[model samples]
Target: MDRTAPPLEVATATPGIAWPGLPGPAGTSLLGLLFQLDRTQWWPAERIEAAQRRQLAALLDHARAEVPFWRARLPGFPPPEDAAAFEAAWAALPILTRAEIQAADASEALLADRLPQGHGEYREIFTSGSTGRPIRGVRSQLWELVWSAFTLRDHLWHRRDLAGSLAVIRESGAGKAPYPDGDTQAGWGFSSAAIFATGPLFSLNVTTPPALQMEWLRRRDPDYLLSHPSILARLAAEVGAHPLPRLKQVVAISEALAEPQRKAIEAAFRVPVVDVYSTREAGYLALQCPDHAGLHVQSEGLRLEVLRDDGTPCAAGEVGRVVVTPLHNLAMPLIRYEIGDLAEAGAPCPCGRGLPVLNRVMGRRQNMLRLADGGRRWPLLSSGDIEKLVAAAPALRQYRIVQTGFDALTVMLAVARPLTDAERAAVIAWARGKFGEGFAVAVETMDELPKSAAGKVEDFICEVPEG
Candidate 1:
């Protein structure tokens, strides 16, 4: 429960150990920037904007000069650019969509020259495709440095115990263990280990059942828990009956989290739920504000725009599409890339941090349920909704709801035993009350619900035709 820094003995226990990729010049630069951000995050809004404008001008110059795609697109553009010229040209550029990025020639998008010194290594990142299609991206070591700095910023902002055991549950590769063993020196290869000693790290596949996951967490007794929103909700439901006494905090990432889910986790575990908004392609987008429930954009590394359907910027409390430009990613510049996500813009935080705020992340549009009247709305199901069916049928282990047609609904259930007629009737009745009797709901027993090709588990999917 102590959020203070680890004891001196723990910090000095592994003095020479370093994280796998953070040991050379790049690592030193990353560590330096992390320390810089620790101070810059407290600066005034105008100062932060000035720093962003400087980075923007440099990135635009690099893109126009060396990137083949941008060179052809921006014919008359010359290198010696200032913030004013950069802003004017950037606003005039068309928005880039996922399909275009996916179909475009990679060689054209990649910078053949002008890469930062000692930043030759690049890695390809892919989207989870929870929405409709998956897109690929390229990022260099310099880009990774920025990502590491932002990650450390998150750790510092939360004041987490550096020596506390960390537990993660997500999709894993084949033959991976439920609790992978750790090395003594690296202590589970945490980023903090590169600078200071860290506690052990344990992980298991999210595909594991709730009962087994509870057993796993109970054994580890971790101080911090990290996993996707859906898995965390399922684990919270299990913990509601039996608590994990050592659990101090929960970190939810990669999926949209509803207020009800947050409340359920907090009530069950009695710990704060810190949500991180990020994408696989763009790295860290926004982090949970320390003083508020909303997210503060990582303005130092990325430029974000929340715009309405007409492409104009959204004002305070307005919900619009999220487009991002990662300023530090020079391997492939994603200028005004539409990330196919929606978020509500928020007023500036009262916490004195100049970072922009996002009131809520509503997730991908394809996931919304379609009404019989041809209207789509996000099905705001609470923990109570899941508990209603689980209580009615004690044999139910897990469940998923999918809307296959305007009037057709399929309820997939993973159960220890087949549901009795009375229990099935109770589930049908609960669905009727929640989704209206107009929907023809059917119960289908299965071993488990299907996960996306990218390994994310979607609890709800709407397959109805959309205009």
Candidate 2:
């Protein structure tokens, strides 16, 4: 064994052994089993809602009883005080933005109230802060198992091997650890099927660097190759230029997987591109199902909602900000926590699961598009108007649309093969369609595009806040 290879000890947790016919990590928890039941298949929505209300009421009671922040702000509004009254005032409850959560010291944003003592065996998860910043938070060990349960449902829908397929993750950085002395196995157990994980940078410059790394990956011939979409696009182009080992699946996680990136990876890897829709499962509130209609919110473990600017529920199909109240994360509870993404909630999913569905999820708040007019900001591109234009030019595989001013903008492109005049014209024609022909457009081709800590390439970014 390579001296650096961490010892592989089969875990005795709920999910159990990761090999074929063996259970995944979810096998360790009793609550996990309860969540796996397909209740919505026959139960009424009203019943689910009622039960959920009771659960929320109980959680809030615990919060008031334990959490310092809630105890201070919610002196009179304790849980069970008036479940209906609290439900009515849900919108008025303190809305926690990323800035607020990240700024919070003393760990108030994370604690669950029911436990008699402090958090035990909890792991912290980090967010890329792709717009520019990233932060970390804790997740209880038990609830992490629940997250695994939810993922199994999504993966099973697609008919992929969750147990023993070779898995790959082009990591962003050394993510937060699940436990002291925690090695790669903890994450590997939750995500990949059997082996190999890497950084997004590894995919790029694979030509000059990782001379041995590339060979190892080829040897693995991983069934699932997961990484940021940007790096995948670059690697896809490289594979087309030369060839790597064929793969059964290519996945993008921790960042939005644009359609262009997906198509590019599929063309190169000769496989369907699946997205995990998360950095870690413990922090995952929503992820895509095999049906590919939209992502299903893990309502059993999380209560996800999308609210418009006024804090009202976003109407069906209308883009709104993503917020979550985690159901089982008792270590540090996230209630009415405004995650940075913009998404729309659809009606209950057709997957026969009682879980509500997210019709569309835009990029994070920082990636909000700056309108070419008076500089209005959009959460994420509600439409693929930009992606469609960039992909039209095959030479325009890597790109970014950044807002410099209300009407002024810069279009950055990392074009290895320069575009033909005709191709550029078509790209511009598409751009003209988006911002009108009179808009200023600057397209620069570079050797590489900037990336976030999570290894995501921001497709659309606006620095201006003057709406």
Candidate 3:
């Protein structure tokens, strides 16, 4: 596929306007940023790092002067002016965690004493608490502008049709777009619609059953669909029966898109699946490359690091904990915040983009399995293995594995009916073979599996305490 960007075109709201392609003030600002990003994305790695250092210097200075929590931690007022000295000082800073952020938020220690002029009002935001620890922070209007720019950048990178209809199936609060009836808007919400005329956007809460969600999609027949990877997987099973003739692409968000889920969606829907790595607190962490499966970090807006257990940078193809610092967010600057996720670092992409690549996003730290020998590994269950298990137990609809001890696992099965004795033995045998031979595996049947508040269900969960 050609990695070149498409020609810039703006749609006019008024048909008879004298300036057909001219955009409004907001649109003009967005276009200005987008134009600059087009060149910055191709900058060399060294150049990108230099730019990030300059921005980080400014952010650190601001944090030390205005934020109380950072004042004590960031000693040596006014960071070093030399590049090498500054780099050393920056690395010496402690990695911030979710628990500390929550503590600081209670006392307003993380917030800036005063906002910069023209930054505009701030709004308080809370995370989904999927990690068992939700955090609160403030987002300035300036931060929102940067987020919107990145959102537009992702759309442009994929060369998506701006006028195509979009469907969103994610968490929805009360009075927002709910289930059954759902909701529809005249145009795609801000960032895209703020600049260009777009097709209507349809939304439905993800809590709706897969069968109903499929019926809703068949009714709307949208061009693009966006939802969590788990939701997409469940919906994939229904697509074989009720197809969406107009569906062009699927975007998986909120959760890591494993290889099995990706293959299932593409095979069932007969369309490409694009995965986006982002969070509620920090927006647009990494977006899938247009020409490759790897993801490119949004270095223009964030300073992301993949660090080893000893706090050193990971080499190419090394899996490490993800740490991020939103360079543009001044209201609540979370410098070097550990986001509780693991990802594999990659060498420079073949696509020629200077952005860093994440070879694969291995889910959260809690998702790894703990062995009796005090070792850890990501549980591997291939699609073929899953098919074999289903073949052995025809009543199995879905399954989730929960680690109860170092050598014990409980397989929760959502099935149509209780499995026969032979089928039960087969399920247990399969789990033991995949996990470990000496491990104890128990099978429990359930009418259906439970989903998170955000309507996401994980295939594995570790209940054992972390050492």
Candidate 4:
């Protein structure tokens, strides 16, 4: 045994057994992959890009030969062997959009004509439909392996306790995970369970009211809580004065974690909030850096790009559209797929990790507010602003802002009771001040604001069509 190795690297020995306890075949394979990932994370940026381009070249070749959609779009010849030429050819390829993927799927042109042997059986995956257009994609066994490896990396990077209980609150179909008394399993699912002896897993449906969810969390008293950022913020508000002392960390997934939400969750739980940027179609994109505020791109499994409208890559601190290509998904190669989200590029991290950094994953373009002058900007509403509004309107439970026109805004409030005239005025005043005086703000009280099928609620949504 290497005593100097990382704690997670050490194998769990069987009781009463001497040195070298069994980790099983599956565990052994996962550990072996993790060992490689451990080293790859430290490889210089140039070395990492060289490796990605090599894999990408093969994927591009396969796409050209097997996938009908790519066959029409990609060059007739294989990807250029030269690194610079390959990059140029890659950049020249059109960005794949969700709508295009849907069209290809309808035409049966998105999937590979044949699978590479030993890649394992195909598994179907569907996006959450948060953008109103859900995409269906196929994943090979190889993709699953990479997903698991990245999942393990996330756990290791956050230094989570595998032996500690995990509570999850996320979208689940009817009868799958019910309210109040959700579901429980013997161990944490997937990567951790496949390799380590873990604690119990508890889950509650995201549709449950925030108050009930908080009550359930207190009862379960799990060491870790995982859910969407919107849910976390609501739960944080429900916390008020009562803190979940047992929670060691909160894992925000699915949606981008806004700065206000992060601060609220951290302040409420008195625990760190780690954001994991991922999609159902493309397993893991980036994981929060353990030592810093930025998120490190999982360059080992995928190629992530932040691009400007001009089709050029964004520099450090510049915001741009997020495009991704899962390097190993040979079954359905989504080369340069635009995931329909915005993000800020980050400078190199001081942590010495070679992986690229994303300063922040801004929400989708539709979430940006469109000004009367035909310009879009992220609506600025600080946590303090929300606190003031809630304080002014004690009956308010939740609120969502929607841009109806270039100069009009609608504020939908879910309240316990009809707000007083002054409370309504306060809400309207806040919206106008946050957005702009030129915009006309209207307030509508409702029993509850509607959440997406995936149990996500955007704080702001722009309905005005882009020019």
Backbone clash pairs in model 3 (N, Cα, C under 3 Å; residues 3+ apart or in different chains), count:
0
Q: How accurate is candidate 1 locally (lDDT)?
A: 0.77
Clashing pairs in 1: none
* 152-246 per-residue lDDT for model 2 (tens digits): 55444455443333444344234332112112332444433212121121122222222333444565455556666766776676564444554
Rank the models by lDDT, top first.
4, 3, 1, 2
lDDT of each: 0.77, 0.59, 0.86, 0.87
Whole-structure CA lDDT of model 2: 0.59
Across residues 1-467, which tens digit of lDDT does each residue of candidate 3 receive?
Answer: 34464444586655577455777767778889898899999999888888888888888888989899999998672344466787777778899999899999999999999888867778788888777777887988888888889888888888777678899999888657766779999877887766777788999987787889988888889999999998898889888755678888899999889898899999999889998999878888999998887999999999899999999999999999999999888899999999989999999999898999999898887878987677779885788888878887899877889999998999999898999999999999988878888779999998879887667788888888876
As a TM-score, model 2 comes out at: 0.76
Ten contiguous residues minimizing lDDT sum, candidate 4: 1-10
Q: Estimate each model's TM-score.
A: 0.85, 0.76, 0.94, 0.94
Q: Per-residue lDDT tens digits of candidate 1, residues 73-177?
A: 754433323555656666677888887787663544554456877766767776777776777778887787788788777877887776788888877665465
Q: Judged by TM-score relative to the true structure, which candidate is superior, 1 or 4?
A: 4
Clashing pairs in 3: none
Report how far off residue 165 is in candidate 1 (Å). Answer: 1.4
Model 1 weakest lDDT span, ten residues long: 5-14
